[model samples]
Target chain A: MNRITLEQANAVIAGAFAKAREMALKPLGVAVLDAGGHLIAWQRQDGASTGRLQLAVGKASGALFLGISSRKIGDMAGERPTFLASLAPIAPGGVVPAAGGVIVVDANGHAIGAVGISGDLSDKDEACTLAGIAAAGLTAQA
Target chain B: MNRITLEQANAVIAGAFAKAREMALKPLGVAVLDAGGHLIAWQRQDGASTGRLQLAVGKASGALFLGISSRKIGDMAGERPTFLASLAPIAPGGVVPAAGGVIVVDANGHAIGAVGISGDLSDKDEACTLAGIAAAGLTAQA
Candidate 1:
C-alpha cells in the first residue's frame, strides 16, 4: 500500500499553515495519519489550544474510518445525528464526523491516509488541508 | 545532510518489534522523528495501551532536544527531579527524561533523528531500539 512520508506530511503542514497565514485565519492545528490510522506528523501553532490537536486528529481518524471526507460524514450526521454519535464509542480514534477532514489518495487512487486541520471555519479548514495536500503533490478525496 | 526515509523508518519499526518479540517483551509502541524533531512515523502494537504512544514520542523528543540518550538524562533527572519537572512546560514536545530514547546518527555522525520505544523495562526498550537501528544499518547514540 502507498504511504505518506514524513517529508510529504511536513510539506502539507507547511502549505496549510502558509495558507492559514495568508488568509489570516486563527492559529491552527494540523495532523497527518498513515493508512493504518497511526499518527505520522502533527503541528499545533503556538497560540492554538491543546484541544485543537485532538480535534484535528479526530477529524482525520473519522475520515479514514469512514472511507470518505469528513464533510460527507458531517452531512450524513445531519440526518442521523444519534446514529453517528454512537460511532465514536466504537470507531477507531473516536470519529469526529465533521468537516475539515480529507482523504489523501495515492497516484493509483488508493486512499493513503488523511489530513485534518482545526481552528478555522470547518469549510475553511477543509480548504486549507486541500491546499496542503496539493502542495505535497497528493490529491484530496473531497 | 542525510535524512531518514519513511522506508527506513518502517524498517526500523519492523526490526525493533522483531527484537521485542525475540525477547518476549510486552506489546510496544515505537516512534521515529526527523532531525527537526517532527514525527516521521509511529506504531502501537495491537495489545499495547493507549498511553504508550505519547510516552514513546515524549522520550524521543526529549532525546532529540537534549542531544543525549534519555538514559543519561534520566540519570540526571533523578538527581534533580524538580528541575527536570520544570522542563516539560518550556521544552519542545515536553521532555520525558527517561531511558528508551536513542538518537539516530548518520554516517557523518550527525544526529539525524531519534527512535523511542515503550512497553517493557526502560533498559529493554532501549536495547530493542538499538537492535532496530542496527538492522537498518544505522547507529544509535544511547
Candidate 2:
C-alpha cells in the first residue's frame, strides 16, 4: 500500500495554502492522513479558529473510515441524521459529515491517504483540498 | 488494587525504548496506563508519527477493558470483525484490536496497569512492552 511521505504531506499543505490564497478564502486549516487514518501532517493558518485542526482531522479521518468523501457523508447525514450523529461519538478523531474531505487514491484506486480543509465555505474548502492533492501529483478518489 | 507509580511508568517507557534501540526498530510511542486505563505517562520517540500517542493509548485501554492483552483482542477481531468494531465506539480510549498492549498484574494476577507500544510490527511492539514491564519489576498478566 502506498503511503504519504512527510515531504508529500508538507507539499499538500503548501499547495492547499496556495489555492486558498488564489481564491482569497479565509484562513484555513488543512490535514493529511494516512490510509490508517493516522495524521501525516496538519496546519492551521493565521486567524483560523482554535478547533480548526480537529475539524479538519474529522473530515479527513471520517472520509478514510467510511471509504467515501465527506461530502457524501454529508448527504447520508441529511438522509439519516441519527445514524451520522451516532457515529460522531464513536469515531476517535471524529466524523464530520461535511464537504472538504477527499481521499487520495493510488493507481488501482486504493486509498493511499486523504486531505481535509476547513475555515472557508465547505465547497471552497474542498476545492483547495483537490488543488493540493493535484499539486502533490496524487489522485483524489472520484 | 495497587497503582503503577509515576516512576515505574517512566521506567517502563525508558526500558521499552532501550529495547527498541537495541533491536534497531523504528521510533516508537509508548503509554503506561493505570488500572483504570488512565494515562500515567507517555512518550513518543523522534520520527514517530503524529497519531502514535492515541494508538498507544487505545492499545493499553483496550487491554484493560477486556482483561486480556491486545494480541488476544486482535485474534478476536479476526474472528469477529463486527463485534470488535462495535466495541471501538463505546470503549472510551479505544479498542484497537492489535498487539503491543500488555496488562501489568500483581502476584495474585489482578491487573495493576497496562503498557502499550507503537511504531513497529505488532509482535515487535509487544516484545518491547514485555521488556519494559520486566525492567520496571512488574509482572505481566499470565
Candidate 3:
C-alpha cells in the first residue's frame, strides 16, 4: 500500500508551520504519522516546550491508529475512563482525545496518515494539521 | 559556561544502555540535554517502549529548564501547577517534573548536562542514569 513517506511528512510540517505563521498563532510542534502509526516526520518549534512534541506525536499516532479524529477519541475516552487509562500506558505516541490531531486521507478516500499539532489552541492546532494535509496533496478527514 | 556537548549527551545515552545490559535490567530509553534544556542526544533500546523515551526526555528537559533535578522539580510542579502549565505552551519539547533525571557534573564540579533513564521504576531510572554518568566519567549533582 502506498504510505505517507518521509518526504510527504516533511512537506506537511512545512505547510503546517506556514499556516501557523499566517494565522499568527503560537509556534507549534507538529507530527505526521504513517498508516501504521509510526512517525514519518516531526518538527518542534524552537520556542515550544518539549511536551508539545511528545503529545503531538501521540495525538497523531492515536488518530491514525484508531482511524478517528482526536476530538472523537476524546469523546469515546471520556465515556470509558478505565479503557482510556489502560490505553495511555500502551500508546506512548497515542493520546486518544487531544485536540489538534486529524486523519490524513487521499483524494481517492484512502486513509494515509495522521497529523498532530500542539502549542496552540485546539482549533488552531486543528487548522495547522489540516493545512499540513492539504500541503501534502492529501485531504484532512472531515 | 560549562554546558553539555552533543558528544557528552550521546555518551550518556550509550553508557546508560550499556549499563542496563550489564545489569540485565529492562530495555531503556535515555535522554541527555544541555544546560539550556535542549535535546543533546537521546536513544531507546530496541525492546523499550516509546513511552520510555518520552518520559525520559520529559524528565531531563524539565530538570534542565527548571535548574533542578526531577526529584525536586516534580514537587514544585505539583505545588505550582500554574507555573508549569504556563511553561507547557512555550516549548516544543515536553518537560515533566518527575524523577529519573540527574544533572551531570564534570570533574571540576560544573554542570555539563543531565541524564535521564526510563523503562524502569523511578528509582531504577535514576540509578541507571547515575551509572551512565559514571561510565561517562561524570558525577551526578547531589
Q: Which stretches of candidate 2 lie over 4 Å from their true place?
A: A1-142
Question: Tens digits of per-residue lDDT for model 3 on A1-142?
Answer: 3678888889999999999999998768888888777877878876454356656766677677677887677666656656555554466464636568898877776787888887776778888888888887877887
For each candidate, what is chain B's TM-score? 0.95, 0.97, 0.79
Model 3 spans > 4 angstroms off: B1-142
Is candidate 1 or 2 superior in TM-score? 2
Candidate 1 clashing pairs?
A: none
Index of the highest-DockQ prediction: 1
**Consecutive 10-residue window with the lowest summed lDDT within model 3 chain A:** A87-96
Scored against the native two-chain complex, candidate 1 gets a DockQ of 0.09
Better lDDT candidate (1, 2): 2
How accurate locally is residue A73 in candidate 2, as Cα lDDT from 0 to 100? 85
lDDT of 3 by residue, B66-111 (tens): 4468878778667644334434543345667777888776666555
For candidate 2, write residues B12-106 as lDDT tens digits. 99999999999999878999999998999999876554456766877888899999998998777767767776774688888766789999998
For each candidate in the order shown, give its overall lDDT on alpha carbons.
0.82, 0.86, 0.73
The complex in candidate 2 yields a DockQ of 0.04
Highest lDDT, which number? Answer: 2
TM-score of 2: 0.59
How do all models score by TM-score? Answer: 0.59, 0.59, 0.53
